[model samples]
Target: MKSLAITVWGMMALPGCRPGEDGEGIALVRSLPLSDQQKLCLEKMVDTFLPDTDTLGAVQLNIHRFLDKLIANCYPEEEQKSFINGLDILEGKAQDLFSKSFGSLENLQRESVLLGLDNEENAEEKAFFDFSKEQVILAYTSSEYFLTNFTNYEMIPGGYDGCVDVPEVPFKV
Candidate 1:
C-alpha cells in the first residue's frame, strides 16, 4: 500500500498542490474567474464528455471543480484566458443553434453541439475542446473512485506462488 499512498500523494502534489484541497469539500470554483453561467456551462460540457455510466460520471467525480482548480491555479494566464474564451465560444455556438444556453440543453442537444464543434475546422474551438477533454480524462482517471473501484489497485502485488510439484522421474540412473 506504500506505492498506492505514494501515487495518491503524487497526484495531490501536482502543480497547484494545496493542503486540504480535496477537490470535494472546497468551493474553489467560485474563486475562479468564470461567472456562474460559465461555471454551469462547464459542468454541462463535462457531463457531455463523460456522462453517467455504471461508474461515476464527471459530475459525480467532481471533475468540473477539479478543472476549475487546475485552470485557476496550475495553468498560465494565457491558457486560462484561452479556456474561458473557448467556453464563451461554445456557449455562443449553443445559443446560435438552440436559442438556449448550453447548460439548459438536453443531453442529445449537448452531444450534437459538441459533435459540431469537434467537426468544425476552427482552430481555437478545436484547441479548447482538445485541452478540456485531455484535462477531464486526466482528472477522471486519477480520481479516487477510478483507483479504488475501476483499477482495484494495490500498492504491493500479491505474493508469488513459487512451489511446483515435481514429476517423478522414471528410470533415473
Candidate 2:
C-alpha cells in the first residue's frame, strides 16, 4: 500500500500533471470544487503548515496548488467531503478562538489555534487535519522543486562498487 501510494504520487508529480493548461501564475484551487472563501482558507492553512523560510515556502513552491490537484484528482469522494468539512471546522475553530477567519488571523494566533486543534480529542477533526497535513508534506517533499533544489536527490545514484572482495566467515553449522 505504501508503495502504491508512492507510485501514484510519483505519477502525479510528473511534468504537465497539472489539472489544467493555464499559463504560469494560475491558481490551482480554481479547478477544485471549493468556494473562493474555502480556497483562501485552505491556502492560508497550507501556508501556515509550510511557511516561508530564508529560501522557499509551500506557497512559493506551489504546494497548495499541488495539494488542490492531489485532493481533487486522487482522493475519493468521501475523503474529499471529509476534507472540505474539515476546512469548515478549522475555520470555525479559528473564529471561535480569535474572532476572525483563519486566513485573517495573526501568525501566532493561527499557530495557537492549530496547536489546540492538534491536541484536541475529536477523532474526525484530528483525522482530517492529519490527513491533510500528511498529503501536504508528501506533495511538497516529492515535488520537483524540492527534490532538485532543496535535496541531494539524484535521478541516478553513483555507480556500484562491484569489485570489492567478499569476506569469509566460519559457519557454526
Candidate 3:
C-alpha cells in the first residue's frame, strides 16, 4: 500500500519538482493553449487510453484537464506546441485510418489509433504521443477518486505512532 502511494507520487512528482510546491496538484490550472477541437479530441483520447473498468476512468477524473494544465505551467513552449500538435496528428491519423474524427471513434478503434501512434515513424510524433500518454496516466493514478476509493489513501493516513513500544517477538527460532 505504501509502495503504491509512493509510486503514484513518483509519477506526478518526477516530472516537475521545485521549491514551495507540493509536487501533487501542480496541474490545477488550464491555460487556453489548446483549440476546442483539440481539447474535445484529447478528452476522448484519454478516455480511450484508460476506459472505465472497475473504477472511474481518466475522463471521469478530468485527467485531460490535468495534462493540459501541467503542460501549460510546467512544460516549455515547444513541448506545449508538441502536445497540442500531437492532437492534430491523432486526428489526422484517425481520419486517414478510420475515416472518422478521433472523438467519434469506437473505443477499440480509438485505442488502436493511440497504440499505432506509439509506433509512428516520426520521432517527434512518437515523443509527443508518449509524453501525453504518460501525463494522462500520472494524472489518473494520482487523482482524488483513485487515491481515496481505489487505493484507500488518506490525506492524513490514520496510523499515527506517537509513542508506542513494540512487543517482543514470540516463538523466535
Candidate 4:
C-alpha cells in the first residue's frame, strides 16, 4: 500500500522531471502547459475524485502527468493537441450547463455531461469527446498508481494450485 502511494506521487511529480523531446523510454514528451481556465478545469477534475485528503493521499497519483505521457506516446502530435483542446471545450460546456466544470461535477453529473456529449447529433464533437475520454483512461492506467498499486507484480512459482488437499485414488483396472 505504501509502495502504491509512492508510485502515485512519482507519477504526479513526473511532468516536471523529464525534459525535451529527445528524452527516452516514454519520458521525452513535454506536458502541455495548462491555461488558467484549464487549470480551473483540472482543479475541478481533481476535486471530482479527490474530496478527502485520505483518498487523495492514499492514491497520490498525478493523473495529469500520466495523461501527458499517454498523449505523447500514443497520439500523433497534431491529433494529441486537438484531443487535449477538446477537453478544454468539454470542460467549458460542463461549466456552462451545470455552473461547474466537468471535473468538479459529481460522478452522476459527469456521466450526464458525457451522455449529452455522446448524444449530440454533431458528429465532430462526439468524435472529439470520445477520443478525449479514451485518452483520459489511457493516461490513468499508465500512471504509476496503476502500474504499481493496482496490479500484482510479484513473481509466481511455476505451477498451478487448484486443490489444497486430495485423496489418493485406487488404480483403475
Candidate 1: list runs displaced more than 4 Å: 1-30, 155-173
lDDT of 3 at 4: 100
TM-score of each model, paired residue for residue: 0.72, 0.71, 0.71, 0.52
lDDT of 2: 0.82
The C-alpha RMSD of each candidate to the native structure, in angstroms, is 9.0, 9.4, 10.9, 11.1
Model 1, span 1-173: residue lDDT tens:
99999999999856444445556444444446899999999999999999998878999989999999888888788999999998899899999999999999999999998888888899989888889889999999999888888797876779877998889889866
Cα distance off (Å), candidate 1, residue 40: 0.3
Itemize residue pairs with steric clashes in candidate 2: none
TM-score winner between candidates 1 and 4: 1
**Which of the two, 1 or 2, has more TM-score?**
1
Count steric clashes of candidate 3: 0
In candidate 1, clashing pairs total 0
How far does residue 32 in candidate 4 sit from its true spot (Å)?
1.4
Deviation (Å) of 89 in candidate 1: 0.6
* Model 3 TM-score, all chains together: 0.71
Q: What is the C-alpha lDDT of each candidate?
A: 0.88, 0.82, 0.84, 0.64
- By TM-score, the candidates rank as 1, 3, 2, 4
How far residue 104's Cα lies from its native spot in candidate 4, in Å, is: 4.7
Best by lDDT: 1
Model 2, clash count? 0
lDDT of 3: 0.84
